[model samples]
Target: MVRDQREIPVRDRLLLAGVQLLEKAGGGDVSTRAVCDLAGVQAPTLYHHFGSKEGLLDAVVSHGFRQFLAARRDQASASADPIEEIRQGWDIHVEFGLQHPASYAHIYGRVERGKRCGVVAEVEAMLLQALAPAARQGRLAVTPADAAAEVLAASSGVILTLITQPEDAVDPGLSTRVRDAILDSITTGSTSPVSSGGEVTTASAAIALASTLEDAPTVLNDAETALLRDWLGRIASPASSGARI
Candidate 1:
């Protein structure tokens, strides 16, 4: 019987190749054949390991999420203040997006449209865990889960825009602005005057604008209205006054 001489595990080899292909051609251009050539493995080995090109993409996204989680955890550990922690977290997220645009897009950009991906939940879990202390201390305005989801979505949008924008485009300061905006929005009515009235002072105005929109029957449905009311109530309570949201 003939035996394969390739000593490396097929799965690992394919994943390594996928990473290389992603680095070279970006996630959208990666192909099974390209990965096979990079890994020095047979086409059958690629299929045996990842089933399909999409499967390989999923693996790449998962791997990127792991790296992202590690970086965020490290950043959070180095920061003592919740506000600084959130700022550092956004910086790390943007850095990852800029550094690994392909992987970042694969994980956050395409996965939502339906892919064999599993990284979103993991990333969300990490975000919630990091924000838990802030939520308890009233430094954040919403439930830990809601805050995590909002922050993740908002930051992902900033990163995606940064990735898709033209290279020569104006330095919109989009990431920093968006990060500070989110923090301010969440902490709008809080006791932290600095977070409340700095350059990001528009957060409170933004909330007021959103509230006005919510009050419009044309804008909000019953469920949406209830959700907005609940959110506002939590942030507007007298006990919550001066409390960091």
Candidate 2:
């Protein structure tokens, strides 16, 4: 049985309306008035709750991401292998973007300078958590942070590309190829010997150390911690280390 949406606060009701509209028409076709009309709230009430249309959309995206993370957390419980877990995460992300094209577009497709989506950071943190076991087991060939960045970028690129294609025409193999390519770059192959070379040792050790840093107790402020991650990323992947979160 469906609960009555009106039973929720007006603010939450408006958010729910925005989400439904986004799913139906995508954000490019949605408007503040449309949301208010759908939500059965006056314009003033919408403004009072959300400040602006942009604010409402931001809230909507945040709400969607929280739900997304909860589902991911539940699925993660069945995870056994960290590297395979990363693959499953990529599949989950692609599934999400394809299933919720509008929400995924709002979350990632609208890029701005100096202003990034908070959801990306949250996802990265989640990725790092997934990478922790791999790092400890010496399966990581890059710092967990760096690996997270690479995987996130690759998955985002794949999904965004697929999202633009006609539903029937989208090639599922594209995502798998790209995902495996990025994973290959970040981790040694299943049969390959680990830490057999100095470079491998440096990268893997850097990953293991970086993974432990979150709980290792450091006096570093936010800035210092950020810079420290940058340095570790250099040791892990010199080419793409400078890419910011």
Candidate 3:
């Protein structure tokens, strides 16, 4: 049943109006007057609910991001190979960008000087969560945090590039190619030729041990565990050669 618009909360109505106008505008300029009219509220009501039109738009973008994250979490498979999960995550990220170009642009394409999008940290955290499993299995060449950063940077770049290209000119294989290259650079799987000898590097061992420590109980106390992590970090660091500068 189509309930009376009056029954809806003013805040929700404003958000719905803002998102509709934003999609209609192709993520371009949207005037407060138009949004207020669409929401059946006066200018002051919008301000009361959202502070300003810009604030409303930020809320819309945030809402879209939350929905995406929830859906991704629901669909994610826990038992899948970690590397494969990362690959699927990359594909999903790209697909979301393509399907919601305007919203995606707001998240990653539009940039302000020295300002970071709030959603980026959450995205990176998700990547870190996915990489933890690989780290535990000695499949990661770098720490989970490092790998997450690399993947986020590369994937965001790919999404922006794809979104700007003309529909006919978009490269079908670009996403997959870039995804594989970045994955290969950061991961050392048992099936990978470089890992054929079943030998683990000092850094890889340190990474795996550090990751596994989180899954099981340890005899060390908080301070000792912290010190141990510090030592492992030093071992895993590429520049930790004990050289005095």
Best by TM-score: 3
Give the runs in model 3 whose Cα sits over 4 Å from its true position: 31-34, 41-55, 66-79, 192-199, 240-245
Ranking by TM-score: 3, 2, 1
**Model 3, span 31-131: residue lDDT tens:** 99999999999999999988888779778877886788679768876645778889988888887778888877667556889977766777888889888
> Which tens-of-lDDT digit does each residue in 148-183 have in candidate 2?
999998899998899888978989899999998998
- Quote the lDDT for 91 in model 2: 86
Taking the tens digit of each residue's C-alpha lDDT, what string does model 1 give over 88-134? 77787777778788887667555444443566676677777676555
TM-score of each: 0.65, 0.76, 0.82
Candidate 2 regions exceeding 4 Å error are 1-6, 42-44, 72-77, 190-200, 217-245
Once superposed on the true structure, which residue ranges of model 1 sit more than 4 Å away at CA? 1-5, 36-52, 68-77, 108-116, 188-245
Error of 3 at 205 (Å): 1.9
Better of 1 and 3 by lDDT: 3
Model 2 gets an lDDT of: 0.77
lDDT of 3: 0.81
- Total clashes in model 1, counting residue pairs 3 or more apart in sequence or in different chains: 5
Report the candidate with higher lDDT, 2 versus 3: 3
